[model samples]
Target: MKFCYKNGILDWRIVVLVFLLYLLHALTVKILVVASIIAICESGILLFLALKRRLDLYLYTLVIILATTFEFPMFVDESLKFVPSIIMLPLISGYFFLLLSLWPLPKMLGNGSIWKTISKKFPFLFSFVSITLVLGIVMGVLSLFTDSTSKTFHFSFFVKDLMILGVFNVYALYFMYSSLIYPQFKQKLELIIFSVLVAMILAALFVSLVGAKGFYGTNEIMLMPLSFFFSTTIVFFLFYKKYSNNHFVLLIFLSCITFFMQFAYSNALGGKSWLVFFLILMTCLIFWYKRAKLKLILGSIVVFLLFPFLLNIVEKKTDGDSLSSSKLVQALSLVSVVDVDWYTNLPLSPKIRIEELLNTNLEFVKHPSFALFGKGFGGGHQDYRYAYGGYNPAAFSLEEYNNEYFIRMHESVNTIFLKFGLLGLVLSGTLLFRHCLVCNKSPWLVLGCLWFVFFWGYSSSLMSIGLSSLFIGIEDVRDK
Candidate 1:
């Protein structure tokens, strides 16, 4: 815990350790099953530590990070083109260990004295968890009457979806309860954040040098953490004056590191990331030079015109084709409704995803009762319609397409609605909102909550146990 130097960057020893850990991740991740097995072993160790009352946040977080970095493949058959990756074991098992270390939920639910203690000690968390139990019941009831087709309904999907839906609550519960047991909670929380930052940055570094499977084995994995780095850096810079250890030099280094991430990732994405990242940088500028409103307006104008040009270029390193040339205009039009859904530019995926969301929403409006309770776990919706833009529709059957889309649950918020319904959405959002409000003084958590809202529109990692501790560690800090 002791750093030789005083600046905000993690100490040299910690950085070295992170790099060493990243190396372990690199070696184990290629087979993916290797990483998965190691993760399972680590989980056993974690459970033992927890039972022995020896586990701490840092150790738990480190193991969880390693386990989560890669997808575990149980079957890889190229001849049949069958490769199935195991998701829930890595995602759910760590949490059982996590929650056990924090508090025993089974006992707490029935214990009158325990409930009284929790209620008096942390009223908001107490209320949040109590409501969460009701939500859990609704989740269970809706799951029982699941509308999932046989093609998509599996026990893993059922459990995985449940976790994704409740990801926020799980972490919030950990954050609130973990506070009672852990001392110097704020410093420990900072370490957890730094731990994630270092882990991902080192992962990105490993990918660049060694040409390995991207962090945790996914090629595009670095993107989120990189985006996160810039985001948290923005918040950190906003409060650069608050923490005695925070340094401007460290801020510059972080900005540059995030820029590298953007550059590295741009080659892989279609276009939306550029727009989002552009906004992130603009926000960074506004905060960086807080007093320059006139300059900010002018800078915005410049970025608005030129940023797309830059994006178009990045989309294609050298493109003279007319359709490719109009990408600038496409980027602009996409931005107009970009906030509607994260689906943008890509022809079939975006169009179908948006259409599916609208269709699912209409289904809810059409059936009030369905909206009240939801389709439950392992739920799937009617494809409603499809628009295969560039690809030949004749090549793929409608049933295949429907099945493919149904299982994805990519439009994350709608996935919540489909499985859990409007009631679930309200309960889930309220739990998150209350937890995010843990410390109004922290703009970081407020902005983070907003980011997740945007994220829910696109991806399905909503329930995955990622960075919940970081949020808890900071947001749960009482105002001094």
Candidate 2:
């Protein structure tokens, strides 16, 4: 993969430069507009060169960089106004990337004949991209008729899921082409990964000291520094697990403990005790599988049983609620397929969090049309603030409500229902279960890394996008 810079100037430097400008945007408040201007200009030039060469990779990178950097942090006013145009660029770019990357496959698999595709060796990759893209487009068009506070948000997220799908395909295609065809491209991945890790550490530190008071605030900052270390640990565990690497194991242990301590004691995201437990259990399971020792299994079971006790101690010291009193069980209880009317008239409990899910789902299936098409992206939650008491747009703000209720639909499965109705639910649900149901090396590793991502999606939309990309990149190959 020796990049011919003399003939066609696309290389690692372009990727690094764009990411640096994005970091600058995230760090300095005043540099947002200026950084975007420079990055977008560079992207335009790259896109022009890519078109001349007919290389879709450059266009793919262009769209992802745009989408990744333009994190619409806040909404301006009654209307999103200029915000919609800015955000839409990424979605539109992402759609083109999808088409460029995987087109005729959709045409062949358009009918109910997708089972043939799912039966392949690498079914996870093919099934996820095909199903999500087809269903997402159908639901996006259908959702346009539904009322929403902002059309920009509605349109952008309508196709937002495609961005992740596109990323997966583009990345896989890049690695395949580089490995089999060019071979030199493999070296470039290491450079990109190393640069990203270094930049994330520096940016995380800078943001903690100076940028905490902004929109992301203190709680996010507490977890910021762990990104680089955690990412590096996962990379090494996946790639270098065959060799003797006690240091990697130590790093993983420290990362888990540090992540738990920071989030637990800081009174940040404390209500998500279920998620914390699930993560701890998954981590233990991964390490235990890697070692396959009886002591590890017994020790994991002990810790699993005592997790609530540990949470109790942590909560008492921090003046937070105990995990035993959490609504996790109640939320899980609503997973059955009951009548809509039954869920609607159910009495509210200590919190209306689960009730909100029931009511929204009822609203979704109340009518045949609504049940078929759904209210679109950014729809289904206009009056959610009333049910949850009040909405707090800021993280860790004084306004005391489950801020997650603002975007999350209690369950990602149900969220799919609210977005694209029964059809969408079936498609996404199939992708979720069938892809990773078999516990192979690649699939298992992806599950370990992203179990919490999918689980948390049931409670919030946090990892629904960013971390989901990791699942697609994992392979059974050791070198990857």
Candidate 3:
């Protein structure tokens, strides 16, 4: 197959045709017409790319398969209503596109010394396995006692989810280890970027379909992992690539756009704490500007900080307080409150919250009698009632707060700790710390990775599929 980009091979005419076809399909209400057009477009792209021997095309196909596989199971259960497969389908597609762009690979130059050093440290793999085994034993024991049908198990769902989560935890560890030791930055970045774009497109489509529901309600949370991947990739790109003044300006503009988009979505859909998200981004920008004094960074920060305040003032003057209670404004207010609360109650020491969170997870710890090595996959209770009292704890509940702290406490912090315990937490933390260390050697990369890590902590579990791709991508960039 020809790998060359021949002249006229990708003409503007073909592009326009594809766009028109897509536009028409989107405008039409006929279900069959839309489906047929989508299938044709997707298939045509695949066929064209394949005929041209563009293996890069496989990235999209892989996303479709992976996203469908991951989400299809949810639809199978008749009891589970409100499945948003439409949103997931496009998200998966966008993720694949992003992955294609950010995969990393080490420079194939004089790097024998680095390879030798990696070879010497190879024994860490065994150490990681041993640690995982110990944690597995602990989890097995906890599962037995907590999951004994006779016992009044409040968190039995933890045990069931643990088995699935445990496997992924191990996979995540191995991925990190491979990333660190092998250091295939180029390949990983490409994969990560590809996955992120696919995820983003899907997320946008999903949110649109769900009439702009909150993050969790529209299953927008799934996109967080993908967002981490792309944001980090962009940061890495800016750090490594030689940039002109124009490029730097563009970067600032893009960041501003992203900040506003997230804010708008948070307001329109009651999913995330918009204020917290904005504050985090603002804080990062402020620190970046203060430390570097780069005009682009400084300008972006100033604009972002002042934009909301100015908007608020204008709204109050024009619309009055009652009329100014727009969804976006309300979301922004919520975010502000949550961010203030988090910092105000910040833990005094390192690992303090994680440690405390682990203790709560001890309720799920079982005895060795249940299984010394560990309960095999899917060994815990399958009942949703056992998990969160028949309530989707991750979902918004009027009974509790909708801030990041509560979300962390319920969805990510407690979930991982309960299932994988200390080992998982340590390994996950180590992987992130390593990524930070690698990227930190360069300021631009460091800033990018930091942005991703912050969002990852706030929105999703470290072991999640999207987060995994993110780490892999960052690791890839570092290798390069």
Best by lDDT: 1
lDDT of 1 by residue, 342-450 (tens): 3545444345656767767766675566767565554555545544333333222354354543433545566656766776577557646665665345544543454
TM-score-best of 1 and 2 = 1
RMSD of each: 6.2, 8.8, 10.6
* Alpha-carbon RMSD, candidate 3: 10.6
Residue 179's lDDT in candidate 1: 56
Off by over 4 Å in 3: 1-130, 133-138, 146-164, 170-236, 242-257, 267-411, 441-480
* lDDT tens readout by residue for model 2, 419-459: 55676666555655654453344422443245333332321
How many backbone clashes can be found in candidate 1?
Answer: 3
For model 3, the run of ten residues with the poorest summed lDDT: 1-10
| Winner of 1 and 3 under TM-score | 1
Number of backbone-clashing residue pairs for each candidate, in the order shown: 3, 2, 41
Model 2 residue 82 distance off true place after TM-score fit, in angstroms: 9.9
TM-score of 1: 0.71
